[model samples]
Target: MRSRLLFYWISSLLVSGCTRSGSPPALSFSGGLVVAQIVTDSLQLVDPTRQRRIPLVRYFPQPGRGSAHKLKVALLNHAYHGKNTDYKFLADNLVAHGYYVISIQHELPGDEPIAMTENLYQARYPNWERGVQTIRFVLQELAQRQPQLDWQHVLLMGHSNGGDMVMLLAQEHPELRQVQQLISFDNRRVPFPRRPYPRVLSLRSIDQFADAGVLPTPAEQTQFGIELVQLPTTIHNDMWDGATEAQKQQMNAAVSHFIEKK
Candidate 1:
């Protein structure tokens, strides 16, 4: 009986140690690329059907360039193919403006280039829950990897379907109290839990999803503590690209101001 008890104690210790050591260290970026130093391991979620793994890239700001303090931001790509182009541009700009940008390649539809709105809404190929889980997984992974990152300073920015994703994530994962601010571009539909966090920014264009209608009615907006910004001449695609230098400056200013206020 004594020996059995000793063995059980040892086993418990081993289990606890493994649990503490299992998590991977946070990824870091140094030079121009600001590439992630550690490769992300597959993250498992509650819904098995939604389990799909994708790579997340990190773009760290050049040290001592813009802001002395490091700000970690997560940029979620629109549903479509999860290509890194749009995010790459955004990350580069953010990095230039003094931010550590981590952009994720969300699960695409059947490994092909397709619109995420149609696929996610239609339930044609890729599952929407999978994308949702991916965002949660990445956020947790970053928290583990970068202890230096200010949890309260973290921001979530998305475009199109990606915009919708930011709202969904903020609503679902209240436990991730670190995410302080959220910004979405050209997103039409606003889900329940209308108010998420203290600061929310939505930028809509005249074309594409905006053509459908403005979501989160003024009453909902008042309840949610959201700030809505509408650009007159911009379109859905313009939200991603095709913005002139003046427009880009305006966007940069808006985002920078939001971060500063938060």
Candidate 2:
């Protein structure tokens, strides 16, 4: 299924003449073990009757032996049917900063297309729920492999539909309090969580097709402590891998600042 998805995406890109941006260079970690490998990893979670596996791209980073720093995980979800490589720049940046990043692809064939309008958008709630299940499965797998993994500092991030999924997970699952921050890139449909926990940081682009739906009212920002950054004259798609050097740098700066905030 994973191979088929990749093939379908590649073929679609070719036929559409959609040129992909270059991936970031692998991060170098001295005196640290940075294992950067892409593998088709899966587990049967939804149905045990059949061997249905949920595929995920895992980026595992382990500190050098005897290192005191605890490992942190970041799960990044791509937009609806969007290429996972769209998140490559952010993922590489996270890994370079010593985070274990996993970029998830959540679209399957025959699923309802996501839309910015509320009437056309409510139909895709189930898809977002399924994405939540996938994240749970991955987290379960990680726990089994590394029992001591730090959940307190986990980061959840996504773009478009993926950003919606991040919002859903943070709201529905109280166990995710360990998720230190939730960062979204131009997610249009879902409203930000109203809680004050698991700090919310959203980045908005000047989307021509759909509303950004990222900004909180000044009152809401003050009350919930939401952090919003609206990029100047930036396209929504440029927030991901297709970003220019300046855009990428801006994204990095925003994210770095968010992470470093006390």
Which portions of model 2 show Cα errors greater than 4 Å?
A: 1-52, 60-66, 110-112, 115-118, 208-214
Candidate 1, residues 159-212: lDDT per residue as tens digits? 876766676677777776777778887655535246557377766665655422
RMSD of 2: 9.8
Q: Put down candidate 2 lDDT per residue, 1-262, tens digits, no spaces.
A: 0000000111111000011233323343433633333222333334243233554565544334224566688888898768655666676566556566766666655556655556644677877887787777767666677666676688989888888888888878967767878998877777778779889887777563333443466777779888877666568877877777667767766776677677
Q: What is the TM-score of each candidate against the true structure?
A: 0.67, 0.75
Q: Which candidate achieves the best TM-score against the true structure? A: 2
Clashes of 1: 1
lDDT value for candidate 1? 0.54
Which structure among the candidates has the greatest lDDT?
Answer: 2
* Candidate 2 worst ten-residue window by lDDT: 1-10
What's the distance in Å from true for residue 84, model 2? 2.4
Superposition error at 138 for model 2 (Å) = 1.8
**For each candidate, what is the lDDT?**
0.54, 0.65
